[model samples]
Target: MWNPKATVENALILLLLTLSVMAKTVFSQNCQNTGCPGLKECCSSWGSCGIKDDQCGFWCFSGPCNLTNKSYGFNYNVSAGPRGPIESIVTPSLFKRIMSKVGNNCPAKGFYTHHAFISAVKSFQAYKRTVAKREVAAILTHFAHGSEGFCYKEDKARGKYCSPSKKYPCEPGKQYYGRGPLQSIRWNEYYGAASIFLRLPLLKDPDRVAQSPEVAFKLALWFWTTNVRPALYLGFGESSKRVDGRLCDNLHPNDTKNLVNQYVNLCKILEITPDEDARSEISAFWRRHLSALMKRCASTRASIITGRYGLSFVR
Candidate 1:
């Protein structure tokens, strides 16, 4: 009548077949024909993901794409470090405004007169090539200072004594001539930056900066990352303003916007963007060096944003 053994065997075979089909469906579902969101999908026909090239696919997430699995087709790691706090605070629109104001206007001629500026640019290039964050900052600081008056010619007696000065000294005004990225001026700043950041005895001999531009360039990087950055980002100089222009009571609505602009301009020079993913990396760079100043100073955040985004008051 009823063959129980045969029926059981048939049922088992059917179950196995169903399980195999289900497994195939699940495996196929891992990848899609179209590229996944947040990830640059490659080989839609093959159901792969990754950067545009024919390399392996990367796992896609909501916020940022993970590139760990991808092969080394590209040279640089687009996403390797933590994003900075400035990313959230700064915006694209604000950065454009800042760059517009601080347009690259240094002279392209005169080697002797433009030596400092040239050195500053070279220092920046070195930083980019090396990815030395502190060095990059120092060079920028030097640039900021040099841009103002590092090698400017001042009239001694309002054109009456236009033949340079012996008392005032024709050898580059110390206080007024801080030109470079971070705008470091005064012997104190230069020496301090050199000593602390670059670990050189530049403070003892101020002429070293002019005499040895390479050494000065390295010192400049140190200063911007360590000193100037702290003063701008985490210090009470610019970050703590309230609406009424007081620490608790003073605030400028435009201040935040302005700071963002400055950051964007810096990004343009450095070729960085303020996307959500990139924010952490940039912030980490700022936080590591400027920790003490940021903690001690209240308005450090505001100052940083303003320095990068607002009118730099270089002159």
Candidate 2:
């Protein structure tokens, strides 16, 4: 019984168990208040975030909420690029109007260019074909809210967004945090996946997204086609759930009301009126409210999100 090797093995087992518990807490995805941070992960009725059918199907809170919960979304195509221009919808005047909402000092003001967005659109040929006016407006609503009119280039204070995996095991000095328009990405698997199409070293160089505006827009499209596009037919509410599940079904009316209002306003700008389910509004109250809420949420989460990863493991 007094075997030194056995004692060491037992100690290693205990250390592994401890690390396992820590990982669970780190990726808890409670979503009772804020929504889950993963672009494609679903929130369950029990308030957890994951990509399994158990998590994404049957009362899933948001994300790619579907019966076919398994994902093979990363195999993207750039072949369909530039067949039709997205600028036809996001015209120069319209783009300017969106940027006007932010002050001159905002980082996104200089970072997000109309040309850059158009270039990104050209890379995905099916985008315009697959999305109609309302769908386009829905995405713009998200852009306006999430990026504050495309001014927020990167999230300076966020968790390292790394999960342990043999294929994409945590790197020694790399930290994949939030960048791009949506800024919800925080997983290594995603970085690796996007890199295949982008043909860049995203896993080692996650900052390329925020640094290059075209790449940023392209990444945004990648997230949308893979995640939200599936559930959008359900209604505007479904779109909201995909973005952040906790914001729907009376979970957070304050947030949901503003989202619907913004969608209504954007649809009108494109001269496309939505049905009653779209909750059309012609005013800009929701825009101001949404901006404020985004700031507040970013501030709150930046303070606590670091706990989502192991320092040595992710960085």
Candidate 3:
């Protein structure tokens, strides 16, 4: 017996399944680990995406969500508001002074502009919590080192840096060697992580990290706030260990030394004393607000001495 109603129902089921697969293929960028895009969007406790109100409002990875069984941790009410903090902290003139240290021989000189850095910084409001003379110096020190004094813009696009994972599958033709300041490596994880967090199509278009300076700096900041900033209170040594433990363990003692020396130099440039324990550093820096107000635009004083790094700046 030909059952028209049954056939119609089966067709509808197939269509719904197809749509679900497509949706997951396109937008599911490892929501389980990094959560969904946007600050208010929710990644359900078991790995599903929807507005904050979905699933009893429980935001698993991100949010002090309205509906929740538990709040693990979230970036609520921490952003530096918008558009002014980075500019105020590192003005164009100040950034130029910082850039002046790069040898004229360096490549990609124009790529790492203050405008690009400021533009990228706008997307990361959590950065507000990490802004201090010592912290800022640490941030820029890693920036210069990971980007190799802002010289090497793109990786050779060699080697399939992809790993097999259903959560964040690799695009067939794309390579995922970390780009930009953080040199955000591990495509299977960080690229997808960045995709969800930044709400950008980074997994599909990983090149954006290298092609646009703003995107590049955003990748760096993403890595920094998520990984480095949290460990900052432990001290610079721990922060460096978090960045690359091998370097700290005598794998490349010189590179580790370079990190400390670069931080010291940048602190000098900002007229700040480099020290341990980031919370106290921020508290202390703000206490001397009158000086910080002037030092906020840390004028690049004297030439920045050259610090050589390995060609591989991966972190």
Candidate 4:
């Protein structure tokens, strides 16, 4: 009566069946309009239904949808970026103005130039389906605050931020302090990786990040495109966590719920409205007031009731 072997076999069959269901695949084009099988599933570039990174990876539908995972920003070639027309909502002039206002006295010169920064941003924007104006503003605001409103590299070198690994080695007599617009903390790994991706020898000469404005901007863009943007799409709280790499409560120890206050403050400086909660609240308030007013009028009909005796008021 106790056939444990048969029961074990049945359990194994069910497990295999569940695995098959979870690993479903589809073409990205097909899922574009219809969407994936599961609500949380995103269609991979290879046309597979998957969750998290699998669905939002580099191969996902490259369009103006803003659905691609921005958790880490993606990079694309000047010509072969996303699939659609790359329209920069933040005009070149506006971008320059913002940079000048927020950046330090450093000139956007040498290898670190404005042209390079603009080109890099254009390429970065191509990866996203829809680039919100507020998002663009937020990027500038964050950089401005991070660098104290300047294209600055930290003056006091704390020490070499070299990793001393076989993959990326520190040059003898060279130090990698915080460099670039966003001030990358440990330059060896982060800058080294970005250098490899960008086909530059930044790891060999880490100082280039500080010397060149374009390079500095590129480093900032790389961070934003990869780590910052994706988290921001989730929400301010998620973005902060991504930036801080810890619990929201830890970041704002005094008031965990107020963790996104810095982001909110930056938004205010940019004059970008906060998320739609305020608008929704205003709408609800008006509806309630209108309903109450109508009810009061209905209950006191005598106040303005239609009467045969001329326009005699009754209360």
Candidate 5:
């Protein structure tokens, strides 16, 4: 029994010696006092210093530390709206992030990987300043509905969209129902114009638009820049008038209201309030417009607000 205690003490001493040696090696090799570039410099998991949130927050070894909340003192005032400078061009990553909220349920999932869509959006010179992101959001929202998530062709069509226009005649056995983002509904007019602008024989090979992601987005860009941008600058009502020419007319009384709801939804997704406060104004707009428009459409029976466009079920 006396000998057993001595053996246990010897083992404990050996273990302590090994641990001390290992600790010294670890400290000398890795834990030396190294300094970063600046006090703001964040030490990332990859052992590099960076300024972006991706680098400093989530990528840091210590986990997300809000440097802004530290003694450095940075505060954001959401109540006052975007106080910081806005980006003129919509970066691909930013666009993808925003669009994901809108088309989360879409079949293709997200924005197509091509320069055409971004290029076309950037070409809108008038809307490039503060309203660029808003306009782009609006266009994408409409496209999400019009093309059903940028589908190349309409899913359901009775016949080939062959136009009988003599000026832009449909080639033999060719159909131009709804190709590309704006659907490019008719061949002789819409498809014809796209073909001329793109110089890709879109008239004969209408499927090129559907097949090529670049061409598909290009068609959408052309439509938005040429036909819709001017009217849209004024408001949704003017934009509808330009596109359909009968916004809330006898034919579709609730159509404008329904469309407004869609626009509001888009604005909400983009975090855009009416007066630039963090508070959303679209809800107020909906309350004022939705009920009256629903009543008017309900009586006419011509235009009915359905759940498809985010309208609540009518009583």
Candidate 6:
């Protein structure tokens, strides 16, 4: 009876606002399923849809035109897989050596000694082989480069350490001097590489390197595929040679040897022949691991597409 045009415009505006709010609510829920596809739940799980925060436990990325595309959660499946046989073969000897360094109580602190490190590597291999469906060599390559900084503090504090370089000083006040099977550190090299590859803010908060091992590993893998591997290929003709140089030059000769031993342990765990040469052995190991990892990622993506679009599940 009054102004029909004005009323229609107001109603449209309200409808748009309501739709926005509803969409926001739907994307903010937590991802309950561990098996959920790539980042479907990571962005929303942090309590605000598409809101990126360092402490949110996920990395969000938007598409061209600023449309939200996806978020990535920390990968923890690396810790899963077959361990018994690998542990039985490598644990006793590796543990004896590690205990001599970090002490017998190291495992209680979530700080894996050398033997524990080997066990983890083997477990990771198994995970890649079975669940991730990625190449073992690629996985091993990721692991080797990613595991760099775990022992830096322990080595330095005990007077048995050498610096990666005087130009890049180690900050003792920082608890995450890079420890673990992966030599992950808070250095610019790692952080920068991770930022670019994972599209995450790894460099902004250095503490995540220590506080979250799974996150650290994800960063490591990202760096390896995007930067480290290419650099290694350029530096040395053979991938194994590059890995050996990284272990010996970037870290320590002993650390390199220890990692090799871990590789042997992993092979034992996987029931595969442990290649004699340090470079070849790890190269083969990672090749197998990467194969599985790629498969896992593909599977995860497929599930997400199916679920989001209401398509029939493929796997």
Q: Write the per-residue lDDT of candidate 5 for residues 1-315, one digit (tens) a residue.
A: 469889999999999999999886554322011212232343343444446664455333211123222211222121223321134334567556545554555544443553656555444454344444456555665665556545323434424655356656777877766655665244345677767766778878877766766676777766666655643333443333233211223334254544666666655655675222344365545433444333222233323434444443221
lDDT of 4 by residue, 126-231 (tens): 4456555445555555565455456455534356655456766667777766666665334466666677766778878877777667777777777677666754
TM-score of 5: 0.52
Per-candidate local distance difference test: 0.34, 0.61, 0.57, 0.47, 0.48, 0.36
Kindly report which residue pairs in candidate 3 clash with one another. 57-67, 58-67, 178-184
Q: State residue 42's C-alpha deviation in candidate 1, in Å.
A: 52
Candidate 3: segments with Cα more than 4 A from true spot: 1-84, 128-130, 276-315
Off by over 4 Å in 5: 1-89, 98-111, 123-131, 151-155, 240-262, 265-271, 274-280, 287-315
Candidate 3 per-residue lDDT over residues 1-315, each given as its tens digit: 999999999999999999999888555435433334333344443445666465224222222234211121211111122223556768888798878877777767777888888777766776544356667777788788777777777654444567666777888798777688765344545688789988888888998887888888887788778766664553454345334322311334356456656776776666656653233243342222212111211122101111232222322
In model 2, the Cα lDDT at residue 205 comes to 85
Q: lDDT-based ranking, best first?
A: 2, 3, 5, 4, 6, 1
Q: What TM-score should be assigned to candidate 2?
A: 0.69
TM-score per candidate, chains pooled:
0.30, 0.69, 0.59, 0.49, 0.52, 0.34
lDDT of 5 at 198: 60
Candidates 1 and 3 compared: the better one by TM-score is 3
lDDT of 6 by residue, 1-315 (tens): 789999999999999999999886554432211111122212222233332342122222110111111221122122233333433434456445433444334332344344434433443333333332112433453354443323321212112112243433334443323433444332344444455555655545555544554554555444344323432212111222222212211323344344445545545545554432334455444333332222222345435533453321111
Candidate 5: give the clashing pairs.
none
Instruction: Report how far residue 225 has shifted in candidate 1, in Å.
Output: 4.1
Q: At residue 178, what lDDT does model 6 achieve?
A: 42
lDDT of 2 by residue, 128-166 (tens): 454466667777787666675566978656667677666
TM-score, prediction 3: 0.59
Clashes of 2: 3
- Candidate 2 residue spans exceeding 4 A from truth: 1-41, 49-53, 67-85, 128-131, 246-252, 276-315
- In candidate 6, stretches whose alpha carbon ends up further than 4 angstroms from where it belongs are 1-108, 111-181, 184-186, 227-257, 275-315
